[model samples]
Each structure stands twice: as C-alpha cells, then as structure tokens.
Target: MARNILPLHKRDKTDTPSTRNASTIVPSEQAPSPSHEPKHHHQPHRPRHENALHSYVNNFWRNEIVAAAAEFAGTFMFLFFAFGGTQVANTAALFSDRATAGQENSGLTQAPNTSVLLYISLIFGFSLMVNVWVFFRVSGGLFNPAVTLGLLLIGAIKPIRACFCFFSQMFAGMAAAGIVSAILPGPLNVSTNLGTGVTPTMGVFLEMFLTSLLVFTIFMLAAEKHKATFLAPIGIGLALFVAEMVGVFFTGGSLNPARSFGPCVVTRNFPGYHYVYWFGPLMGTLLAFGMYRIVKIVEYQTVNPGQDFDDHEAAAFKPPKDAETAEQVGRPNVAALAVEEAVEEAVRIVSRGSREERDEEERIDGRLERGEQPRYVSERELLGRTGHGRV
Candidate 1:
C-alpha cells in the first residue's frame, strides 16, 4: 500500500459529469463560501406519465361534459333494458297459441291475459332494480325525467345538471323505443297506449295519484338517510310494482313520463292527450314535495321534541340512540346549558326572596289584627335590637 500511494495533485479526477464540469469551469475572481453554496431540492421519485395521467383524469371527471355524458350512458342503459323487456313480453304474447282473452275452456273461463301484466311488471321492476344498482353512484339512478325533475325541485340536483339529465332520459327513451320497434315485427312494433283503457282525463288523474305515491316513496325511502337507504332500489322497484298492479288497467301505470314518451314517439300515435304524461308526473312531483315536507316536519318533531321546528336544522337531529351516545361522548352545548342554569338560578333567587317578604308581611298583618303595633324595620335596626343578626 505504501508503494502504490500517489500525490493529490497527480491523482486522476473521476469522469462524472459534475467532476468534468468542475475541471472545465473557469475560476471566478472571488469564490463563494461553503454557506453560500446553492442547495438543490430533490423531487420525490415519480413517473412523468403517471402525473400526466392523474391530472387528465382529475380534470376530465370534474368536467360538466363528462357528467352529462355519464347521465346519457346511464339513461340509455336503463331504457334499453326497460323497453326491451316490454317489447319482448308483447312479442311473446302475440305469438302465443293460448287464448289471451277470458274464454270458456274446460268448463271454466280461463283468462291468461293477467299473465302478460304480471310478466311486464316483473320485467320492468327487475330492469329498474338492476339499472339503479349499476348507475346509482354515477348518475343518481334517475332513469326517468320525472325523477330528475323531482330531484331538481327538491334541491338535490342543480338546474343545469337536471336539464342535462332530463334530456338524456328522454333521448334514451326515444332511442330504445326506436330500436325495439325496428327489431320486432311490423304489427308488434305498434304501441298499445301503454295498455291503458281509461279516458284521457281519468288517465291523467290515475297517473298523477300513482306517481305522487311513487315519488313520495322515493323521497322517504331512498333520498333520506336511514336504514332503508341501502335497500332504496328494492323499495323503489316494489313501489312501482304495486302502483302498476293497481293502475295498470286504468292508466297503463306509466308513472314515468320517459317510459310512455318512447312508445308514443316511435308509434307516432299520440293518445289524444299526450301532455297528460308530462303534466301528471310534474304535478305528482309537487304533491311528493308536499308529502316530503310533511314527513320532514313529523320526523323533526319526533326526533327533537324540544327544539325549534326549523327545516334547515332538521338534518342535524340524530337517531335517539346515536344522540344519547353522542351526548355522553362529547361535551353538551355549553352556551345553551349555561343560559338555562342562569335562568333557573334567577327564578330560584326571586322566588325565595318573594316568599320571605310575604311571610314578614303576613306576620305584620296578624300583629295589627291583634291590636299590636306593626313595625317595618331596616336590617341594621333589626340587627342592633336583636344584638345578633340571626334572630
């Protein structure tokens, strides 16, 4: 080792970039001190492509265009399944050999017509359930324009976004109807007024009443936070199923305007009062709004009995058990408790003083009635006369 040692001046410099640059650098007139050396900030290890992709994704998702596109896609998927089911049922019934009408067979009148209704109901309900489950997080599962309107009226969705949702739903309905019409036979493509038999006026009322109940159910079970929120889709589907069962004959149970709109447009057969579908659902939304308000009021009263009835404050009320547990875990509302304590103390002080004054006045009145001289003495005088203030 001693034989191999070399002087620092004769040693070869490393060929690294920094060493080469240092060697080639022209010496400055004045060299900066070590303290003045530039501190290099090292960025954390990250792929450039990853950062680019992340920014693109973040901006894309937040864009309104993407939201509207999502709405369109969800609505299209929903209507495709809903109307496709309808056409399938209708086609099957048309080709069936069994007597759809109530006819006397085997010495008994056998009506297979009810089977069609049942089939349609189940299909529609299933379609709704699946679509809602699939698209709930992205588009709020609003496959119906009326539902979008309801959300708008309830302040759940903004007006512009609601408009986009409405347009998407209607367009999807129309597209689904057209596709169904094209795929099925000519005779099968013809719409059946959604199977409604009632007059226009009766149909409007039926739709309004039924849709009101449906929207009411949605508001109560799905929109509000509760145990049933997880089962909202099922509850909504059942509500529609029940409404269909009740109003299927009277108004075709077309609670959704989009459901009716598609068939009407494809067939070009506007049942005399085409506006009924729109008017009915919108009116039903208003009724639902009223019902939701009443429900919120009742819920508020039930949850917070002693609190003021304020709509904005209703949401803050928790379940009984949760509230009690929260009260135990956290400090109570100190300001309100302090105010109550002050009020109670004031009342107690005033009452005690008033009672003592009444007793002294009563004693004086009794003495006067007995023909004895009554005296109203100051505290200092009484203390001096009694020698001790206790008496």
Candidate 2:
C-alpha cells in the first residue's frame, strides 16, 4: 500500500548552518501564552542562537543515551533467548537419542530434528517480538547493528547516535551470548563444532542475503506510520523464521554478526568463521540499505518518510523577522475562550429556563443519585445548560 509521509516543519530557521552537519543543534520557540504580550514585557532578550544550539545538541545526546541503552537491553534479551534456545535444543536432541536407545525394543524413535528447528526459530522470533514490544515506543526497536546502520544510510538516524546504537547492540549481543554459554551445560556436539549454524562460505553469503531481506522488510513496515509500530518486529521475526527454515541446512542462519560472534567468543572456538560473522552481516547491512533506497525512490519519492531533518535544523536557529510580535499575536486561547463562552451561555440559559426544564433536570439528577439510567438530553439543551451556545 502507498504510505503517507508527514512533511517536516522547522521551528527556527536562523540557527541552521548553510552546510549540513551532524552535530548542529535546533531550538524550538515557545509560543507566548494568551495572558502575556510582547508590549507588556519590560525588556526583550536577544536570541542566543549559539547557546540554543548547544542546548539542542546536548538534549540530542541525552536522548541518544536513552536510545542506546534501550538497544542494549533489547539486544541482550534477544541473544539470551536465541543462544539459550540453541542450548536447550541441542540437549533435548541428545537426551531424546538416549531415551530411544533405552526403549530399543519398542522400535520407536523421535529424532527431534524438526522439533529443534521449530523451537530455535520460535525462540528467535519470540525474543524479537518481546524486545520490540518493550522498546519500539522508546528506540524504534532496532536491536541489530545492521538495522541501525540501515537507518543511518537513509538519514533516519544521525550518524553519531547511529554509531552508538550499533556498538551498543554488538556489545550487548556478545555479552548476552557469553552469559548464556556460561550458564549452560558443557559443550554439546554443536558447541564443540564452534556452533556455526551453517557451512562456511555459503553460510556467509546466505547470512548477508537473509539479513538484508529482514532489514528491507523493516523499512517497508516502518514507513507505514498509521499502522501499529509493533508490526515491524513481528514482520522481522517472521522473516527470520522463514530464512532459518530455508537456510538452516546450508548456513545455520546467523544473519546477525553479533549473534554469531557472541557464542563463538564464549566457546573460545572462533575457528576462522570470524570472517563470515563480520563481513557477511556487514555486507547484508549495506545491501539492505541499498535495497531500501531503491524501494523508497520507487514507492515514496523520498529516502525516509517520517524523519524531521528540517525541524531538527530549525530548532538550532533563531526565529525569522516576519514572525508576528509576541504582543500582536491574535491566536485565540482555545481552552479559555471555550470556558468563557460556556459560562456566558449557561447563565443566559438558566435565566430563561422554564419550570418544566427545571423539573426535568431535577429528575435526571435524581436518577443519577439513585444509580438508575438517566434520560438522554438533547445536544442543544445540554450545551445551553453547560454554558455553551447551541451546538
């Protein structure tokens, strides 16, 4: 479906530098209240454009910290579920075989091959869903470095903040995987084999392709802002599941480099698969960015649909001269105007009310007092009684 992209509006145009820079600050003007006027002020302060920019950049960094922390927590949780599931699956397979041998006379065997695949995929999928649910509202639910990098490429994220998110995700992934390894039972055969999910060279390429596809899906879903944001994570998880099912035989489906690196580091079995872990996922991230750019050009005519670069730049500068003086502004105070009109109308209505109207009001009041259903009042009458004019 074609998506609606919200246009970016600038709050201040003065602070923005002619040359675009990542660190530039943008300041927003506070609208003067109805009770205050520019002429009533004793003195007007000159705009401190540089100071405003400094504050803006500082606030941006503060928000970046919060975003990076969320990314860390989400990535950690994802890796914990993923690696923990792998451990449990491997152990189950081993015990299942042992049980089959014990019941040899029964001539029945439960291979657990399908079960393992299903469980692993589900673990990854569920992790993604939960993390995204928890963090989407806060940090856009970017739990992977590749996803963050793709956002940067499309200018959805500032370069500095994007770098922080990427590193945070990588470290968090590594830490979570290491922790899972420490708590699990000694090396299963899978762990001994470096826990590499697929064959080497082919696995790398597959990881690149699958990761790119996953990221591309995220961009498409995210562009549709009217839809629930939670769908991005669900879509991403399902994409991962499908890829796992198709690629598990060939490459173990390590679409995320950090996911691969974490287990390998803790197991102390890098085994030259490091090339795939890093290069493969990096290639995938770049490919995803490129694919998203192509799709964006074809679908939306812009690289990113919901971003507010113009607003960000405006926030860093001073207001323009043609802007109305704070005193001469004629915008009505909605709340105050509504209240005043309501009061005036209500007084007038009460002064003109008949005995019948009074009795009806009393009856309604009685019904409310007795917890019975009250008679519905007409909109005109209700508005008049509430001190608002006719609807």
Candidate 3:
C-alpha cells in the first residue's frame, strides 16, 4: 500500500474557518512514472438504507448500551460503598458507645463520630476512584446524573440519551443502597428509620457550590491526557473528603444527590432533602460546565493541533471509502484476532500445561462461547507480545 502523508501546520488562534481550511490541506499532484500507475481510491458504496441501518446498530451499542452500562455500574458501586460505609459508621458508633461505657469515662464523641466521617469519606473516595478508572474508557467516568445533564447542556451527550442515563443512575443508586440496607442485620423499618443523611437549605447551597468546584475539577483533569488522568480520581476523592470534613456536621456532604436520595428513598425518610438533592447538584453541574468551556478555550489555544477531534469526528461521520477494499483488507481484525489468539492459547495450555491451566482454558473458552470478548491485557503485555517491550 502506498501512503500519503499530510504535513499539518498550526493555525493562528484568531484564524477564520476559511483561513484554517486553507492551512489544513495542501494538495500536491504527482505525475505517474511509466513503471508506477496512478492509483485512484474509490469510496466504497452500499445501499443507503442498509448502510444507515448497519451504522445505526453499530453506533447504538457503542454510544448507548456500552455508555449506559458504564454509567450504571459506576453509579451503583459508588452508592453501594458510600451508603454501606454510612451504615457501618452508624453500627460501629453504636458498638463503641457500649465499649467506652464499661471503661472509665473517656471523652469520645457519641454515635456518628469523627471516625465515621473519615471512613465514609474514604469509602466514597475509593469507590469513585475505582469507577472512574473502570468507565473512563467508555463514558468518560460520568457517574453523576447532574454531570451527565451538564454534558448534555454542552452538546457532549445527546439530549435523549442524557435523560436516560440520568434516570438510570438515580434508580440504580437507590436500588443498590436499598439492597445494602436490607442485607445488613438491622431494624428493617422502611420509614424514616435508618441513617438517611439530610441537612438544612443553607447546607444544600454550600454543597452545590462545593460540588460545582468538584465537577469543574473533573472536567479539567479529564480534558487533558497528562498525569491528571491518573490524578483525576485522587483529586475528586480528596475534594469529597475535604467537603465532607467541612459539611458532614451540617448535612453529611452529599455532593452527589443520588448518594443522598438513594438512602433517603430506601429508608423512606423524605425530610425535604430531595429538593436540595435535585437543585443543588444540578446547579453545581451547570456551573462546572461553564467553567470547562472557559478552560477549554485557553487549553485549545495552548495545545498543538492534533488528530483528536478530526479523527474522532471522521470515524463518527464518514463511511469507509471503499467497502469492497475494506472487506478484502487482510489486516488483523482486533476482535476476531483476539478470539483466535485465545483459542490457540487454550490449545497450547491443554496440550502441555497443568490441570489448573486446562481448567482456566475451559473457563476462557466458555466465556468465548457465551459471546464474551477476550480479556484485555495491559499495554505492557501487548507491547511485550509485539516485541517492542515496555515503556
């Protein structure tokens, strides 16, 4: 295959669309030699309706199902750990009271102590970090309904899908919290009984401000692919930790409305906290979206022009130029290649390895039979296989 390389020039910050387009492509026509014929690349064509349907199905899974699942799982895990930690905090305090009474009067705060605050904060932080890590590849770690709504406002997510994801996160959070509450040994009174954290209106506004700051931090960290990628969760977690420290005494620092509303619904304690839960987080999210737009403008000017937007948009908007050529192309199909590689691996294992290896191979094959893709190994492992070694 003959490759055509296009050299890209940096456009001025103030360049108009036409001026940018002028600098974008510099076409050069090369005369063909007697030995080398000019190769014309014809775009692949298909029936418009068939093509549209194929494209829609492919994109539906990529943009909807995969995206929604990531949001759902992230939200579920976050609520599970957060509310679970809250319950644990309450239970531990109950036990601590009994222990401290037996001994001489030691000056410790009563049930729902400082330790509870720290533990709950840590759980919320850790769960968020894990969810971000898991879903960053898919939905960009948008675990919050408010954040999703903000993205919709900025044209990041489609309006219809945004509504679906927001509701999904809320429902998932509530269900997960309810399940956690049920499994734990306690008075199963579903009427303002359990620890459903709520606070005053002032506290709600404060939480909105703090959550806005936190969401802004997430936008900034995710916008760039630097050390901030790894630090995003830490930054978010620490922000939550600090917020909790300041606001736990007032309203449990429920920066996440789903986190607050979930427990409240499960425990059946509608202490008018729902108003703040909806309005505060949504307000903060919108504020954060504004901050991101400003920051993006500055960042865009500073960063060198690259393939990020161009490549992404091309994949989304354009069809392959040659359908027949694409089908005939012999390059490895990543999905198919993975399955073949896994099968070969299993054969090698069963042929020469231990019982454990055979059992593992069977398990892997079962997953494959059940339509699961091969497990994605780390970049280091991939590099090693390619003989380029690690970074």
Candidate 4:
C-alpha cells in the first residue's frame, strides 16, 4: 500500500467566459443565485451543419407539408361554404311556382333575379373573408391556384411550395364540390358557365380582367408586406365580391381554376370554353407578374410625391425582385438635415424674440420722448427706467 499520491493542483473556477458570452439558465424549480448574474449550465454545442440541416428540414420540407395541408383545409373550407351557398341560391329559385313552360330553366342557368345575384355575390365574398382570416397565418389562406401562381411569380413563395399548394387547392376544391353535390338534393349548379349573350372570346377576356384585378390586389396588399397587410383579407374578399357582382352575369365569375374545375368534375360536364378559366387566370397572372416586376425594377416608391413620411408610415416599397434594393432612398444625411432644421427653427425663434424686443424698445422710447408720466416706471424724471443708456 505504499502508493505515492501526486499533489492535487486545484483548477481556477474563474476561468470562463463572461456572462455576456455565457448561456443563462434559470430553473423554476431551483432558487436563483444570490449574485445578480445568471447561472451557467453545461450544455453541448451543436455543429453548424446540424443547425443548417435542421433549418432546411423545417423550412423546406416540414413547412412545405404543413402549408400544403393548411391550403387543402382552407380551400375546402372556402369552397365548401361557397359551393353550399351557390347550391342554396340556385336551388331556392326553383321553388318559384310562377314558372311556365315558356320560362327558362333557373336551375341549369343562373336566374337574372337581382336579389339572387346579390345574394351569391355576398355569399362568396363574405365566405372568402372569413376563411382567409382563419387560415391566412397557416398557408396564407390561398384557396385559389391563381393566387399560388401569382405568389410564385412574385417570389413570395418557392416554386415547390406553389406546386404543393396548387395541387392541394385543386383537390380540396373537388372535395368541396363532391360533398356539396352529395348533401344537396338539387343539381350542382355552381359550375362556371357562360351566361346569355356571352361569347367564348368575351368570356376569356372577362375572366382575365377579373382575375387580374384580384391578383394585383393580393400583390399590393398581402404579398407586399406593409402596415396594412393585416387588412389584406378584407380587400381581397371585396375584390372578389366586386368581380362577382360585375361578371356573375357574364362568365359566372370563374376567377379561379379550382373553382371551375371542381364543378366540372362533379357534374361531368366541361364547357367548350372551359379552357377560358385556365387561360384567363394564367394570362392575368402574367399581367400581375409583369406589373409587379416593372414596379420593382423602376423603384415604384420613387414616385412618392409630397409625402411627409413618418417612422410608422411607409415612405417606400420594394418589389420582391429588388428585395435587396441597394439603391439608397431619400437623403442619407438624415441627422445632419435634422440638425439643420433645428438650427433654422432656433434662428427663427431668436429672430422673432429680437423683433418683439425691438418693438417693445420702440414703444418705451416713444413714451420717453412724449415725456408722459410713464405710469409703469417712476414718475419723477424716469429716464433711468429704460436700458437705452438712460441716466
């Protein structure tokens, strides 16, 4: 048992990074340290590649799936209520007992009743607003394929994400249509069809123009990311509402291919002008894309004229293409300009004070010259009451 014990050199506990660099841990179960600094814990450091992989998986794969699922559910919700309301609107008119043999088929074709048209328009608009408000945080509540395409073109979302969302919305549309068809006793009259006196050419153009308005609004309001972005659902819903009001009598206002495709599939009756919906939205997407790109390249905010922009207000906007806008905007010497303004204001105040002082002096001199009692000062030879070398 004659083992020699080596001297134990105690290590210094102070050999560690400062609290600024060290990790802070506060456990609720344990009492805090008396020293007003955070207690450090021994935790393993993760590799950069692991962090990179985690980010990629979460953002690229996991988020894409979650977004797609959200889009599916959101689309189903939007189209379900929309299709159900249409069914009600279309089916309710059929109960009219005043119909004769000479009268038109209201079920197969939308009736020209002003009340019904307004009802359908409001139903679609309000449904969109409500559902978008619900799912916007999840998948942006993009219930339309045209919206996904527009976002893709504007680089708001990746192409892969757009594809997933597009497919999800399409299938969801079909599901909504199929469910509505099953639950409702009447025909699935929600299909997009040309109205009276509407030609194929006219229908295509109508859809194109209508969809353009919608995509443009989304680009400006939602995708652009401004102080008013939270109000995007309202604006977007109203855009659809107005478009429906205007075009409901023309081409059934099929601004979305999913909306068109689902009804066609459920009824197994595709109109010859069915291509109109697809082509029109695609063309409109291109239009919105072109406008968005042009505005971005030209620095659209450059046209802001006579605006007294504050910190909370948006003084400028950038296109997704020019997101990294290297071009400097406004005066770079902001502090200097502020200082100059303050100096000018101070000068004005000083000048005003001097002018008032001069005027008071003039008034005092006038009273002195008049040799009046000058009631406010001593009445007996009151030259000393003034500052003009009075004695």
Candidate with best TM-score? 4
Error of 1 at 67 (Å): 3.0
Backbone clashes in model 4, listed as residue pairs: none
| Superposed Cα deviation of residue 211, candidate 4 (Å) | 0.2
What is residue 178's positional error in candidate 4, in angstroms? 0.9
lDDT of 3 by residue, 1-391 (tens): 3323443322113447985576557443443343564345344487555544465578665667767777888788777776666666656665667553211111111234667667766776777777777777877777787777766777767976787687778887788777887797763222111122434567557768878877777766665454346667777767677766655545556677677667667766576445766777777887888777876655442333323334433333333344333222222334665688799999987876666655655665566568675565653354355453422
* Candidate 4 or 1, higher lDDT: 4
| Model 4 RMSD vs true structure | 13.8
Q: What lDDT tens digits, residue by residue, belong to model 4 across residues 81-120? A: 9889977776666666325211232223355776777878
Which scores better on lDDT, 1 or 2? 1
Q: 1-391 in candidate 1: lDDT tens per residue?
A: 1332553322323459996577567476454555765466444588555544465567544544555667677767766776666556655655573355321111111223677667667767777777787777776788887788888778888888888888877887788778766776543232334232457777677788888888887787777755357788888888877776666545556788887777777766676677777788888888889888876655443444424324533443333653433233232344676689799999999999989866765675566568666354663354455353333
Judging by lDDT against the true structure, name the best candidate. 4
Please identify model 3 stretches exceeding 4 Å from their true place. Answer: 1-58, 98-112, 187-199, 224-227, 296-391
The window of 10 residues in a row where model 1 has the poorest summed lDDT is: 102-111
lDDT of 4 at 317: 27
Q: lDDT per model, in order?
A: 0.65, 0.64, 0.62, 0.77
What's the true lDDT of residue 57 in model 2? Answer: 68
Candidate 2 vs. true structure, TM-score: 0.56
